[model samples]
Target: MELSLHIILEKPTAGVAFGLQKGSGNKYETVQIQQTDSGNLDFYLTVTTKGDRLKDALPRFGGPFIQGPYMGNFIYLDIGTLAGQVSPWNRRLKIPMAGITWEIIDQLSADVALMLKTNVAGTAKDGSPNCATVKPFNGWRVVSK
Candidate 1:
């Protein structure tokens, strides 16, 4: 079965929190996103999973999707099977953004938009990124972290 998961990631410097609320389970704080108190780009990811059973894979999708002090320069999204594992947390299906010019982060927002349409439509198995896009992220080297 193919599953589509919509996930939200609050930008590191954004003065708002976009995550699960109390008793919210995994749903966002609100059904409709609140306008950011600070103007920073927050991530909204449409992740597709390649798997046989969504129930079996659903449990594995939460950890990496949660906000944290990742200390990485770029935002990451997983578009493959949640059950697939390379790292203990399963880091497959990331769109690379290494060496991407962070000089104008807004410019890169188009990449995220395009990805949400095309690449996010599908995914691969065995930890391979699915659905290639044109020069997706211009990575120096992509290692799913």
Candidate 2:
């Protein structure tokens, strides 16, 4: 079967980048969203899936936060659960995605995705962060495309 997971990213930081990987051991692939006359900055993540059961079919998600030459794991959504959600789902993420600066991005690791802090991207070094910040994102919605 073929299905598309729709992800709506509202106005995000110009340079900040985030994206999702289909499953483990997979790289990111971006979907092009046509610009509207309103001139809003938006992007989409359409996860193509196949399977008879949604639980068995949908794979766990692992995203990345990228700025300049630095990249770190951003978010993780493990599916196939009774809750059928990862965290902070269908709601605004509290943290400012803009904090993912090049100055501290390299210090982040995939472990940040585990913290599941709706707003906090984890603690940075010194005044350390356990998570890597995303860009200046207003909001995001993941549905079906």
Candidate 3:
């Protein structure tokens, strides 16, 4: 039961498209970026997964955000269910500049694969427990046109 997820950061349109592909299945459960808001650039995602169309997964799955050092930024997707819980499926995606798009995509894909493997194996990937006090991503560069 291998699971793979891919996210394409659409720069020109300031949107994102991601899909989860299970083993041997060409079909993918996709999440399209419907809208973005100020303050952490919270993504309002429309998810179609497992025969369910979730109009908004943010409320349940937690919205993703971006933050990083100068000249680079990374998006973080929190899969944790609630505060003070350990999240095995948390994903951190780096937003690449125009020149390094392919590299970033490969990296993110690998990360997603590894996370899925660990989750399926029922092994805990050591990490700090999710806390509410942590500050949200301050930079909101991605804007909708």
Candidate 4:
């Protein structure tokens, strides 16, 4: 089964918190977001498996998985370049001077998790029992902070 989640940010600086339930028992995971000192956003992931069913299924489903924003594929845009392209008459173009929004961060996190899960499943199908730690196809864009 494939799952996707979308979280709207309440504010530009506000963090995001969500949970991902796995297996048929009390196994679950938490994904938390926080701002770093360098003006970058970071994620803290924690997985918990308390049932025997979940522990047994860990080999196939791959448990104890954690990830951050830098572990996924994303696109970045340069605010200055974007603003420069706008016509002088159209002064309504307001550029964001702050860091990235939580929406983008949440989407990136979901995308990374999905990719990791899919890769692990595919590897298992190919007769590999271990979870696959595949690198993301690309990295986020470096925007001016």
Candidate 5:
């Protein structure tokens, strides 16, 4: 059997969609997407900083500085019926950031996907957000080159 899944992370605007101004402060810099597994788009979103400025600033900020990109986890559930009763397929996956995890939720001709929400520390509210429909580069196409 062959099964594959695709996941995309999108912002609420066209500019954010293009990664123009996503990071906060001067820490924001260009990052290369490092792939761990291309089959599921598993990768890392990282950024680089110049000089020891970040190092010196850490003391002032009173905390240890962690560089980008932070990884996240993914969880899956399967809702099935047994003996005319509903049952759950308890499944959990530690899907690192830029990773995808999938499992058959049901045997019927139905599609299943999971949506997760992580509370983002708010940045400057400069523009309106595309909260209604936030999508990846191609609506769901997550990988490019």
Candidate 6:
């Protein structure tokens, strides 16, 4: 079953937060980002399947697509295909920015959990950074908190 997922990250900052919202040990300190009234950056991502299920009785079709920064990366989509399926399903997700660079972030799948929660570690090209921790701020679903 090919499906898409909507991933969301909340309350992103630099040198603060953990898990998936950590910034590059302040490396992204100067990175440009839009802030909300409550002081949070939101990222939006959309992923889609590549083919339909019922082909013209041709060979089965469908597969996974991956693209983005390596190591400590964030994925927004997760595409799944059966042994011989045709059509594919899709999901949408919105993530929060942890001061990471746009060039470093990539979208791979569409079914990945709308990780309303995550960390923002620095990019590899930017060099290693100190360990950062992250967690939900209000202990609520990404939509509520």
TM-score, predicted candidate 3 vs. hidden true structure: 0.20
Query: In angstroms, how far off is 14's CA in candidate 1?
Result: 34
Query: What would the per-residue lDDT of candidate 3 be over residues 1-43, giving only the tens digit for each residue?
Result: 1223223222211122222212112332222322222111223
Residue 102, model 2: Cα distance from true site in angstroms? 42
**Better structure of 1 and 3 per lDDT:** 1
Specify the highest-TM-score model's number.
2
- Model 3: per-residue Cα lDDT at residue 77: 35
In candidate 2, where is summed lDDT lowest over 10 consecutive residues? 76-85
- Highest lDDT, which number? 1
Judging by lDDT, tell me the better candidate of 5 and 6: 6
Per-residue alpha-carbon lDDT of candidate 2 for residues 7-104, written as tens digits (9 for 90 to 100): 33333322222333233334433324122222233333322212223343222222332212112223332211211333232212222322322222
Candidate 5 displacement at residue 60 in angstroms: 20
Q: lDDT of each prediction vs. the true structure?
A: 0.28, 0.27, 0.25, 0.24, 0.22, 0.26
Local accuracy of candidate 6 as per-residue lDDT tens digits, 20-139: 112232222211223222334333333233322354221121222222233222332111111111223221121222332221122222324432333332212233222222223122
Q: CA RMSD for every model? A: 18.0, 17.1, 18.1, 19.2, 20.6, 17.4
Candidates ranked by lDDT = 1, 2, 6, 3, 4, 5
Off by over 4 Å in 2: 19-40, 53-145
Give lDDT tens digits, candidate 4, residues 1-145.
2212222111222121212222222343223422222222322222321224334322111133422232131211111112133222211111111233344334445554432111111112332211223222222232221
Give the range where candidate 5 is weakest over 10 consecutive residues by summed lDDT. Answer: 75-84
lDDT of 2 at 75: 35
TM per candidate comes to 0.22, 0.25, 0.20, 0.18, 0.17, 0.23
